[model samples]
Target: MTPLIEADGLGRSYQQAGEAVVALSPASLRIWPSQRIALVGRSGSGKSTLLHLLAGLDQPSCGKLAWPTLGPVESLLPEKVALVFQAPSLLDSLSVAENVALPLLMAGQGRDSAARVAFALKTFGLLALVDKLPQTLSGGQMQCVAMARAIVGQPKLILADEPTGQLDQLSAQALLDALFRHLADSECALLIATHDPVIAARMDIHWHMEHGLLSCGERTAGSV
Candidate 1:
């Protein structure tokens, strides 16, 4: 079967404090539909950088990155990939529903926006908080809202960077469970960059990175 996203010989580098630092080595990966995987690494281990490349949020310093396929025949633009950062990354002024609906609304999908917002709220257990502001919610709740907003547009792929990084243990587990439940129901391929062992243990596939190189783990039952 064709892969939903692919990256070949992908690498990224940035100059920090007068030193050229390589954030990611030459790496290649493929994510098929409905797969839930966790990318594990300590800070500065290239997890976020690889996630950016996978999501097309940033271009690789070298190699090819693609959606559905890895070439010009039909490579998806950044808009087709939904990214959820460690921070909520929500608009400070927007209401919960408005923020959740922002992507669809931007796509000229006004009629479907309301329904999408409602469904997302229900999924995140935030139905009553739809009118609340981001400032009023706890870190966990805010992250849920952000996750909903990310998926509202129904992109083919979802990339997350340490999504549960800020929450307590229980809250983090709840968030991961809700996220995996949603993935079980959607076609959105998942690539979550995380360091939590609890969350990493639940993934169908797992990869660990050190010095910018990722080693694939033993395949679990749910891995593609």
Candidate 2:
């Protein structure tokens, strides 16, 4: 089967203070459907940079990337690939329901957007807070809403960057539980960047990043 994402010697660098800073070293990997992956790394280890490159949010300075199973880079957003950041990044002006519904609306799912939004909110147990603004929700609740928004469109891949970074241990676990429940039997692959060992252990495959270099372990079941 074709991979959802494939990278060949992918890397990125930035010019800072008249010097080149390597954010990520060339790394190659394949992300197949329904694969659960843990991108384990410490802060500034280039985990986020790799994610940004995969999500097409930033252009790579070197190497190649392709979505063989999905499509061209232009067609990966709010559908084939969804990215959830450490920050909830919710629009304060929009209510919980509205925030979750934004992706569908952007994808032109006009007629069924409301129903899909409702289901997504319900999946994360945020239905009661549908009308609540971002400011009114707690940190955990905000992150749940963010994840709900991500899955509303049922993207093939979800790239999460330290999703539980801001929550307490219990809250973080709860947030992950909700996410796992929603993705339990779906074909939506997940690539979560985290420093937490507990979080990393839950994934099927492990990828490590250190000092801008990336390494991978053997793949487990449910992967291509």
Candidate 3:
């Protein structure tokens, strides 16, 4: 079977002060459907760079990245793939339910299709805040809403970048449980970038980044 995503010698760089600055060195990895991967690295270690490349938010400075089975990279987002950024980028003008339902709407889902939106809110424990705006919610609540939005479309893959960074330990754990449970039920692949060892421990595959280098392998026991 074709991999969900494949990167062949993928890398990214930028020109800083007329000199080339390497943000990520050429790295290769194949992400299969329904696979769970954790990307761990310190700040500026190229974790975000790699995530952006994989999400097709930014093109790699060199080499190639492809979604062999999904066809065009642009066509995959918000449908075949979803991205949850580090910060909750919810549309403030919309209510919680609207925010969660936005992706589906953008993907051509009709407004009459509220069942998917309702399910996502209830699953993420955001049902109570459905009518509320983002500004009125707590940081944890906003994060929950973001996750709800990401999964509402039932995308084949989710690319999350430090999704739980703003929450307390307890809330983070709860959110992670909900995320994994959603993925399990939907059979969706997840590639998450995180700094927490506990979060990394739960993933099946580990991608470690350091000084622009990326190395990936299956998680070893007690390696967290």
lDDT of 3 by residue, 77-168 (tens): 78888988886698999999888888888889856648999999888787889999999998878888999988999888899999888888
TM-score comparison, 1 vs 3, better candidate: 3
Clash number for each model: 0, 0, 0
Top candidate, metric TM-score: 3
RMSD of each: 3.1, 3.0, 1.3
TM-score of each: 0.89, 0.94, 0.95
Provide the overall lDDT of each model, using Cα atoms, as 2-decimal numbers: 0.78, 0.88, 0.87
User: Residue by residue across 67-146, what tens digits does model 1's lDDT show?
Assistant: 65433422333245778887568888999999988878776787867887898778778898989988998887788788
Task: Give candidate 2 misplaced runs (Cα > 4 Å).
Answer: 219-224
lDDT score for residue 77 of model 2: 84
Off by over 4 Å in 1: 69-79, 220-224
Q: Model 2 Cα displacement at 35 (Å)?
A: 0.5
- Candidate 2 worst ten-residue window by lDDT: 215-224
